[model samples]
Target chain A: MSTTLNPGERPTGYLPEGADINRNIAARRLRGKIWQALFFSSLVIGLLALGTLLYTIIDDSFGYIAVQTKIDPEELSDRPLAELSKEELIEILRANISAGLFRRFDRDEPFSERSKESVLQLIEERVIGREVVASFKLTESLLERERIEATVRERFPRARLEFHSWLNRDFLTRPMSSVPILAGVGNAILGSLWVIAITMILAVPIGILGGVYLEEYASDTWYYRLIETNINNLAGVPSIIYGILGLAVFVRALEPLTSGAAFGVTDSNGRTILSAGLTMALLVLPLMIINAREAIRAVPQSIRQASYGLGATKWQTVWHHVLPNALPGILTGTILSMSRAMGETAPLIVVGASTFVVFFPDSVFDKFTVIPIQIYNWTSQPGSQFRNIAAAAIIVLLVTLLLLNATAILLRNRFKRSY
Target chain B: MTVAELSAVDMAQANGRYAVELHNTHIYYGSFRAVKDVSLQIERQRITAFIGPSGCGKSTVLRAINRMNDLIPGSRLEGRILFHGKNIYDPDVDPVEVRRRIGMVFQKPNPFPKSIYDNIMFGPRINGWRGTKAQADELVERALRGAAIWDEVKDKLHQPGTALSGGQQQRLCIARALAVQPEVILMDEPCSALDPISTLKIEELMLELRRNYTIIIVTHNMQQASRVSDYTAFFLMDADRAGQLVEYGPTEQIFTSPNDKRTEDYISGRFG
Candidate 1:
C-alpha cells in the first residue's frame, strides 16, 4: 500500500517503506521456483505411475517359457507341426484321440472345413499335449537366459525352452481354454464390441434428448429440480449399483424381452449380452447427460437469441442452432463414457458376463463376456500363464479404447465451432 | 410533449397514417415496471430513432414490439401494440409469426457461426421457405444486396460469418433479418459496437432501407438520431425510475427546437 511516487530517487534496492525490494523479489522468485518444482514433481509422479502400469502389463506379455509334452513331437513327424497340411494334421488328430471324440469334433465342425492352423492346434492339444511347466518375465528371460536353460535341463529334461510372445496371432484368434497357451481373446473381443454397440445405441440418443429437454424445454418446477438432483447424484453412484438395477430390471423382471424369447429365439436365459449392455448403458447414462448439458450450456445465449429473433420456433432453434454447436462437446463426452464402459468390469460381472465364454455372441440376447471381465477371470486363475494372457488382453483393451477415442476425437474436431 | 397535448388529429388518423402504434404500453420485468405508459406512432417506411440514456428501457420497449421479451423469465407486457390496425398481442397471434414479420438486429453483431449464405438462409428456412437451388441463390443475393454488403461478401459467401470484420458482421446480421421479408426491422444500437466508419456505413444503410422497410433504432448518440431518423422519440427516467417518453416529433424539431426541457438538456449534453 505504499503510495510513494518518487521511489526511483531513493536507493535502488530499497522500497519507500525501507523494505529491501530486491530481497522481496528474490523471495517471490524463490517461492515461484519451489511451486514450479512441486508441479513438475507431481507431473513426474503421474507419468511414473502410468509407466509402471504399462511396464508390468508388457513385462508379463512376452518372455521365455519351458514347455513339456506328453509325447515327443519329433517322434510323430519329421517336419514342424505348423508346416503340416490340413489333411495331415486332421489324420494325426484322428489317430491319437478316441473315435468318439473325433466324431464329436466333426459334429461340432466338419474336418474338411477346418483350416490347417486349427487342425494343427487340435493335434497339438489332443496328441502332443503341450504343457507350459515354467514361465519367466521378459526382464528375467532377457537377463537369466543361461539360468533358465540350466533349470529346464536339470528339472525338465524333456521340456523345451523357447522365447514366446503371449500376444501372438493365435492368442488373438482362438477362444478361451483351460490351457493357457490355447486361450485367445477372440470371443471376449467380440463380446465387448457387441455390448458397447448396444450400450451406445441405448444410451446416446436418450442421454442427448434428456439433456435437451432439461436445458431447453423444462421449466424450473420442483419435479424438474428433483430430476436434475437425481441425475447429478446418479453420476456418483457406484457402477455395481447400476449392475444390480440392470439385473433386476433387464435380466429377471424383463427376461422374456431381454432373453430373446419374446423374439422367438428362446435358447438363451436372462444372462445375455443385452443385459450387460443395458447395465453399461445405465452406468454411463448419467455421465452422458451431464456432459451433454455442459456442452449445451456452453453455447452462448446470444446464439439462441439470434435464432429466436429469426422467427424460429423453440424446436427449430434447438435443432438448428443449439445442437449443432453442442455436438463437438457431446462427442467428447461420448469418448470419455465409451472408454469407461470399455474398461468397466464390476457392472458387467454383476449383470452376468460369463467368466469363461468360448463362443462369440451372435445376437444381443446371446451369452457374452467382455475383455475386462476376461482379464479379471484370467488374473484370478491359479496358473502363472494366465497372468501372461491377461496382460495380452489388457493390451487389446487399451488398443481398442485408443482406436475408439481416436474416431470420436476426429468427429469432434470435424464439427468443432469457434463460438 | 405530454401525450394529451395536440394529439387529437393524430389519433383520428392513427390506423391509416402510422405503421405501428402503442396505446399506453407498459412493460414489466417481474413486479418492476421498466417502461411506463408510453404512447407513440411510427410512420410506415420511415426510420424512427428511440434515443435515451442507458437503462432507460429503450431496448426493452424495442424488444416488446415483436414479443422478444417473452424469452426472459418473469417479463410481462400490458396494453397493446398495434401493427396494420391489429393488436399484435392478441392471444391467437403466435409470437413466432410476429417475430417473422418484425425482425431485429442486436447491439452486438450476433451473426451465427455459419457461412454467410447459411446465415441469411436460416431465417427463410426456419419459416419453411423452400426453394429451388437457383431461387435460393437469388434470394441470398437479394438479401445481401438489400443490406448493402453483397459486393464485399460475394466471393466469400461460403466463409464463416464470424470471420467478417465487426462492421461487416453487423451488416450481415441486417441481411439475415432482411431475408425473412419482414415489414419492420428493429435495431438495438446496431452501430454502437462499430468504429466510426462502420457506424456511418450502417447509418447510410438505414436511410437506404427507409424506402422499402420501416426501421426503428435505439441509439445513445444524438447525432445518429438526428442524421438518420425521420422521427425521433426522446425518453427519460421519471422519479420512479420507469422510462417515459419526454418528446416525440420530427428528428429536426427534437434536435433544433425546444420542447421538454429534459430533451433540450440531454441534446445539449447537460445531463442524461
Candidate 2:
C-alpha cells in the first residue's frame, strides 16, 4: 500500500493514488460486465430454446390439410352435414357405406334415434370416410395455396382442397382411428385421467403415512435407519425398473386380483387400467415419500414441543398441528411426482399400456392408453401422416400438465395465505 | 395426602398446596446424566424460579416436572416426581394427563402458526371440548384477558398469532396455556428472547398468573429471579458436567444471604 505523506510521518491505512485506483476500478467493472453479459446470454439462450420447442409443438397442432373422401361428402349429402337433419344424414350414411360398416354403427348407437351432433359425428366417422392425404403448416397453407391446389389436383383428383386445422373441436372428441385424420385424443385423455386418479388414491395416503411414521413415530433403530436410507436411494431408481417390479408383483404374483378375474371379469388379463395405474404409483412412490418427509421435517421442532406441552397426544399433535402445517409442502411434492408420473413412458409401456385401443376405459379392468404412450405410438410410426395427430396429442399432454401444476400452485398459495 | 387420596382429584378445588415434589430425581439424555439428585417442592399458587448459568440443567430439572423430558429420545429419569402426592412417572400414570394439569411456556414465544383464537382453542379442542361456540368464545376471551393481551388482539382474533409483536406473542402463548385451565404452569426462560420492557411485562404477568396457577420458571437472569420469584433454587454444574442443586430457600433470604460460595459468585457476576 502507498500513501501521499511526509517521509518521517507514519502512514495509516495507505491507499493507491487516483490513476491506479481508476485503472483497478475499471478492470473490476469490466470483469463484472463480462460476467453479467455471459449470464444474461445464458438466460436468453435457455428461453430461446423453450420458445422454439413450444413453437414447434403449436406449429404442428394447427393448420390446413387437403382431405380426400371415398364418396364425396358433398355428393352424398345435398347440404352441409351440420345443417342436415339426423334422419337425412342417416339416409345418406345408409346409401354410402357398406352394409357391415353401417350395421356396426347402428349396433353401437342406432342412427334412427341419433341426435344431430351424433349424426354429424357419424357422417365424419364413416359416411364421408375422409382421410387427410396431405397436410400443411399454417404459414405454408396461407402462402402456398396455389401449390397446395395443384398437388391435390394431381394426387387425389376428386379431393376437396379446404382449410382444416387438425386440432379443432372434433379432434378432442373422436376415438382412435387407423386413419390419421380420424384419430383423436378422447380415449387417451380418459385413460390418463383414470390412471392418474388411481395413482393418486394409492400413493398419497400411503406415502404421507409412511412419511409421518418415519419422521415422527419410528425409533432410531438400525431397522428404521435402513428403511430411511433405502427410501432415499429408491427415489433415484429408473422408472423402467419400477415397471418390471410391477409386472412381477401386480401382474404375475397377484394376477387374479389385478386382472379383474377375481371380480369375475375373465376377459381382461393382468394388463388393465388397474395394473398400469399401480405401476405408475410404484414409479412415483419413492418421490412422494421423499418430498413428504422433507416437508414434515421442515415443520419447526418448537411447534411439536408446543403441542406436546399443551397435553396433546402424539397422534393428536401430528394430526392437528403438524399435518395442517405440512400439507402445502406435501401437495407440492405430490404435484411434482404426479406430473412426472403423467409424463413417464417406459414404465407404462413395459406394464402394457395399449397403443391401438379404440374404446375409452369403462372400468379399471379395461385396457388403457395414457397420453405419453399414445404420443410415443404416433411419433414412432413409419408414415409421416401421423405427425399432425402426434403433435396435437403432445399439446394435450402439455396443457393437462399445465393445468395440474396451476391447480397445485393455487392450492399452495391458498395455504400460504392462511398460515 | 394418602396414596389413594392423591389419585383422586377435586375438580373444583384444584390439588394440594404443594403442587409437585421431586424426590432424588436424576435426569439423563442418552447415557449422560444432565441433572443429578434434585429434590424440591413447587408450591401451589406461587412462582418458583430455578436460576443458574448455561449448561447447569435448570431447564432439564424444569422439564422433569411435567415429563416433557420424555419426548427427547433416549432421555430417561430416575426416582420420581409426585403431583399432589401421586408419582407422575407411575407405570399406569399417563404423561398426557400430567401435561394437561401442568402447562408450559417455552423460552422463545412459540405460538402456533394459526389464528389467535385457534392458538388459544387448540388445547381445549384437542382435549375433546364439546362446548358451544359461545362458551368457546368466552373461554378465549377469559384466557386472553388472563394473559393481559385481550385489548390489543380483540379486534384481530382471526389473525395469525405470529403477527403480534414479540411481547404480544409471548402473552398470546401464555393465553394459550391458560385456555386449558391447567392448574400449574411451567415457564422455561420465558423472557430471554424479549426486550427489557417485554421481559418486565412477562415478569408482572407471571406474578398475576401465580394467583391462580402454580408457576415454575427457569431463568438465567439473576435479577429476574429476585424480581419475580417467591422461592429460588440455584444450581451449579458439578465436576462431571451434571447439574446439582446448590441452594434452595425463600427468594428474599437466598438473595440476601446466599449460603454457597458459587451462588454468591454467580450473583456477584464473578464467573459463570
Candidate 3:
C-alpha cells in the first residue's frame, strides 16, 4: 500500500522524529491533570459541608457554658422577712427593689399594693443571688455571703465584681421548672439510666438468639426469606409506630404487671418507667436483630466445617466456636442499637413518659422523664434561658452516646480476627 | 501388564491387609452424578493415592470413605463404603462415630480460633478420651512429632493456631487429625496449597505415617503420587459426567506401563 499524508500531517517524518508522539503525550497529560483537579475539588467541597455542619452545632450549644452573670451584693441581704411584722418586712423589700426588677411586675398592681409579690421577689433575688438556692440551709448561707460581699465592696471600690457562669450546682440538682435557672436534670438522668438498663436486658438476648437462629439453624426457605425481608423493613419503620405498639401492648395489655393495683389505676393507660423502657426496646429491636444476623452470617463456613469435622455437635460448634468469633461484630451492632434507643423521644412520649417529673424514678412502675423529653420540654418554652438549658442537655446526651459508641469500637478492634 | 497379572498383583498386595472397601459405590450431588460405579480396596499400613485432574471426583470419592459427604446438604451415596468390613452408611451407623474413627485433613488448612494445644486436644476431648493432663500433653506432642511440626511449634503451643505459617498451619492440621488415634486418615490434596519444601516434608510424614495407619490421599500432583504413594488410582471423567476409575495398581506399574491408552496419555503428561 502506498502511504499518503495530509498537508498538516507528519508527512512521513519530514521535519523531526517523535514530534507527533510528543504532542500526543502532552495532550494526554493535560487531560489527566484536569481530571485530577476536578476530583480533588469535589472531595474538598464535600468535606467543607460536613465541617460547616459540625461547626454550627458546636457554636449554638456552647453558649450554655459561656454566658457570664454578675450577682449584685445589695440584692442579696437577708431580711428576717418571714419573722418580721408583715408591714415592716414589706417596707424593707420595697426599698431594695430595683427599677429593672420592678418593671417586670403586673401593670395593674401598684408597687406599694403588691406587697406579697414584692416580698417574694426580694427573697428570691437578695436571699438567693438571682438563682434558686437548693435548700433552706443553703439559702441562709448564700444570704450571709452576699451581706459580707456588700461590706467588702463598699470598703474597696476598685475591687472587680466576681462574675461566674450560671451552669452550676443548682442547674444540676433541681428538677425541671418554668424558671430555667432553677431547673436540673436529676430526674431525667435517672430515667435514662433505667431505660438503658431495661432496654439492654430485654433486647440483647432476644436479638442475639433470633440472629443465631436465622443465620445458623433456619433453612433458606420462602418463610425465612420473608422473615429476613420483614426484619430489614422493620428497622426502617418510623419510631412513632413502635411507640403506638408499646402503648397498646406494654401500657394497656400488661398494665397490672407494671403499675401496682393499690392506686386502682385499672385503665392501664398511665405512662410508667417500665412502659417507656419497653417501648424503646421495641423501637430498636429490629436494628439489633438485623445487625446481629449480619455479624453471624459473616463467619466463615470453613470454621463450621472444621468444627463439624472434629466431631462436635451442632450446638457445641455454635456455642463454643461460632458465637465467640462473631461476638465483636454482635457487640458493635448492639452498641449502635443502644445509641439509637437512648436518643429516641417519640416512642417514650407516646408511651406516656411525663414531660414534667419532679422526682427521680423510684421504681419501674413509677412515672419518669428522660433527657430527650426534658430537652423537648425546654425547647418548647418561651425563654432564652430554657433554650440554653436544652442545648446543655443535648451536649450531655451526645457525650453519653459517644462514650458508648467508643466502647463498642474498642471491643470490636480488640477482638477482631485476622481471618 | 495384562488384566490377569494386574489382578494377581492386587490380590498379593491385599493379602491379610484391608482397611476400607468400596463396592459398586457411586456419589451424586442432587441430580448430577459425581463418582460413578467403582470398586476398590484400600490396604492397611499403605498410602493409597487418588490422582486425577480437576473435577475428576477424586476428592468426592475420598470424602465418601469416611461418610463426610453426609455433611453436604444434597449429596447422596449408593452402594457400600465399608470400614473394617462394617458399612459406614448403614442406618444404625452414626456418622459422628465414623468420623471420629476415620479423621480427615482438608485441602486448605483450617485451624480453630484456639491455642495450638487446644487445636490438637479438640478431637480427643470430643470423643471422651479420659486421661491425665500429662497423657493428653503426650498425645499432642506425639501427633505433632508424627506430622514433623513439633519443634517449630513446641514453644508456642499456647498461641493461636492461626498465627502459624502457612506450611506450619497445614502441619498443625495434620497433627490435629492424628490426635484422635484414627484407624484411617483421609487427606484431600493436603499439600496442594503448600510450597515445595512444605510439600516434601508432608510427603515424608505421610510415608512415615503409613507404617501405623492407612492413608488415602487425593492429589492433582502426579509427582506427589509417584513420590509418596505405594498404590495409585487414576480416575477420568466419562461421557455421562461421572468420574470412573481407569486404572488401579502399583504406582511404578501405572506410571511406567499403563494398560489403558487414557492412563498412558495421562502418565506421559500429554493431557490430564
**Whole-model Cα lDDT per candidate?**
0.90, 0.87, 0.79
Model 2 residue B216 lDDT score: 95
The sequence of per-residue lDDT tens digits that candidate 2 reaches over residues A1-419 is: 25656789766886768798998899999999999999999999999999998888777777777777777666765777778777787788788778998899889887767788887777786767777777887667778888888888998897787776777677787778888877898988899889998999999988999999999999999999999999988988898999998888887888899999999997888988899889989878888888899989988889999999999999999998889889999998899889998999898888888999998889999999989998999998867668888988888889889988998898888886332
Look at candidate 3 and tell me the lDDT of residue B68.
Answer: 79
Q: Return the TM-score for each candidate structure.
A: 0.91, 0.89, 0.80
Deviation in Å, model 1, residue A105 alpha carbon: 5.8
lDDT of candidate 2 at residue A267, scale 0 to 100: 89
Model 1's C-alpha root-mean-square deviation from the true structure amounts to 5.0
Report the interface RMSD that candidate 3 achieves against the true structure, in angstroms: 1.5
| Model 3 DockQ, alpha carbons vs. true complex | 0.46
Mark the regions of model 2 whose C-alpha exceeds 4 Å error after superposition. Answer: A1-41, A70-129, A142-160, A417-419, B1-17, B130-134
Residue B247, candidate 1: Cα error in Å is 2.7
| RMSD of every prediction | 5.0, 4.5, 10.3
Looking at model 1, residue A223 earns an lDDT score of: 100
Q: Give DockQ per model, in order.
A: 0.69, 0.53, 0.46
What local lDDT does model 2 show for residue A114?
A: 73
Tell me, by DockQ, which candidate is best.
Answer: 1
